[model samples]
Target: MIMRRPAVAGQFYPGNENDLRELIKKLAPEHTPSKIPALGVVAPHAGYIYSGRVAAEVYASIEEAPTFVILGPNHYMYGSAVALSTQEWMTPLGNVQVDEDFIDCLPIGIIDKDELAHRSEHSIEVQIPFLQYFFKDFKIVPIALGLQDYDTIKELAGELVKAIEKYDERVVIIASSDFTHYEDVDVAHRKDRALIKTIEQLDVPAFYDELYRINASTCGYGPIGAMMMACRERGAKYGKLLRYATSGDVTGDRQVVGYAGIAVY
Candidate 1:
């Protein structure tokens, strides 16, 4: 049997199905678009209470079936390129089957499996409940990206584009990330906005340079980099900064983590 992992079910999201359902309903956009989005979305993955509204913006932009390729950073473990879990992902709602077929089609060395790496990782799990709420009958391709060079990421993105090209599947690609962790609220806002501006311009190299210069602590930088490559290859024309805020806004703390919602099209 393919194991179904439930890493952060109770901590990041509600553990109860009814409660989780209600929370998603409340957080989802009031008016979701009827048209499908060609490009993917980049969303923050913090505690739901802190980042749910921002995430809702990304979900609202997705108006199609439930198949998604969720790319997230490896917060718990580190290894080679991207890690693909063979296990199914479990949440309060149910188990979401991993799209092993798609995983197998990716180029060799592009994907690997490390059960321990995903056992407690919160980034990918935090996005599941929201996905379950919006998409009913869908499959997932969960990738935990580790340290990788730009060329490696670009290669993987290119292969993914080719692998999924022929199918007319309603697929939504999501990059799970949070911006600038543990800085003063005001400072985080300014820094994250600058980063967001670079992202809007579709300038990944500039975004990378600026982020490093400022010592921005974006945990999911690798995944974001890979997503940018994939988006560019898939003809993503523009990016929208849907929402931006810090954890301080939610908890009234002087020090906070930055969160931003971005959509690419």
Candidate 2:
């Protein structure tokens, strides 16, 4: 059995299980509002110190499911344009099962099973611990996208919707992304807020247009688009912005990377 080991342990998050758990306990709110049955969520992928709270807010607000479909950007473009990993993923928390049965439902043509694409990607890897913290028994389907055009995202979303329908367990789609890379805090907020508003509307075209208009350096627009389209197809009403912050908020730096946590239900 191939095991996809943690690539960013100790870097993005703590490598020690105890420390990781402690940190998550602290970052996650003490009082979680009544959780909702969300179809999908958009969470950020960055160092835990920077984006962990945003991720925690999204996770805490949503109800747990038997399976999670995590879509993240291919930062290195290491493998296939659209890559899916069939191997179980390992984090400091433990080995999380990969939903191979669910993966079998997806066609090989569009989303190839390529471990290389996920080998060193932190986007999906960072989200696993949060899942482990909230749910005890669950499986994940991790897909890394190197090609994130609107058409590709839409096609992938359609395939995901079909797969979820055929599967027996409840599932939630997570789009792992971080917005406005390394910019002045004011600029980051302005650009990210515009994109966040567009995301709340579930308007893909306007999101893309706003992204282009500002030339935002968001890392996972494709993943966000896929989640929005898939959730809309599944009858979700809209997205709610639970939290928004940037690295600057943590470190008091002028330049920062924006993070937003949103839930679609």
Candidate 3:
């Protein structure tokens, strides 16, 4: 079987298993997680020190699931519009089994096996340690999408719903995205709020419209939009913002990247 090792291990997170486990323990919140399970969640994909706390907070709120469908943006744009991986993802913590069953069932237009697209993408990889920290036994379906129009995302969502039904009923959808990249801290906040509002309201179409019209500088808007549709189709009524922050909060930088953890229930 092909093993997909970490591409950003030493850079974005610890490359050693012991160190990774310890860092996650340190960053985790100290409150009991809610019993309410979420259908989907949106988490940031920055380095651990910058966005780990927010990601951990949102993760702490989720209930158990058999599988996780992680959707992320293709920052490098090396593969197909929607790329899937057949290999297992190797993190410092351990190897995460990819839900090959689900990937095989996905329509070709929705997702195709493309290891190159996932090889160097940090967006989806950053969230795996959190999964390792939170659950003992669960598989993942990692999808990387390029800049696709809303119509494309809508079609992908329908395929995703069918894939989920064919794969696992107990699943949690996660979209890895960093909002408002490399803007003034104030400007980043302003732009990210627009995206967050749509996420909290669980407005899929409005999210696409705002991302285009307002030019909300989010890198993974497509992933978020796809998750919104998946959540809606799964019968989620509302979404809530668990936490929000920017890189400026960790580093004293004028130009910052906005980060947030949103829960869709």
Computed on alpha carbons, the lDDT of every model, listed in order, comes to 0.78, 0.93, 0.87
Best by TM-score: 2
Tens-digit per-residue lDDT, 208-243, candidate 2? 889899999999999999999999999998899999
What tens digits encode model 3's per-residue C-alpha lDDT throughout 36-155? 589899999999999999998888778878789999999999988788877899999889998767667777665677888998999999999999998899899988997667887788
lDDT of 1 by residue, 115-187 (tens): 6667667888888788777767888888887654566667667767865674456556788999988888888
* Top lDDT model: 2
The candidate 2 region of ten consecutive residues with least summed lDDT is 104-113
TM-score of each: 0.92, 0.98, 0.95
Supply candidate 2's per-residue lDDT for 63: 94
Runs with alpha carbons beyond 4 Å of true place in candidate 1: 32-38, 78-81, 166-168
Question: What local lDDT does model 1 show for residue 203?
Answer: 79
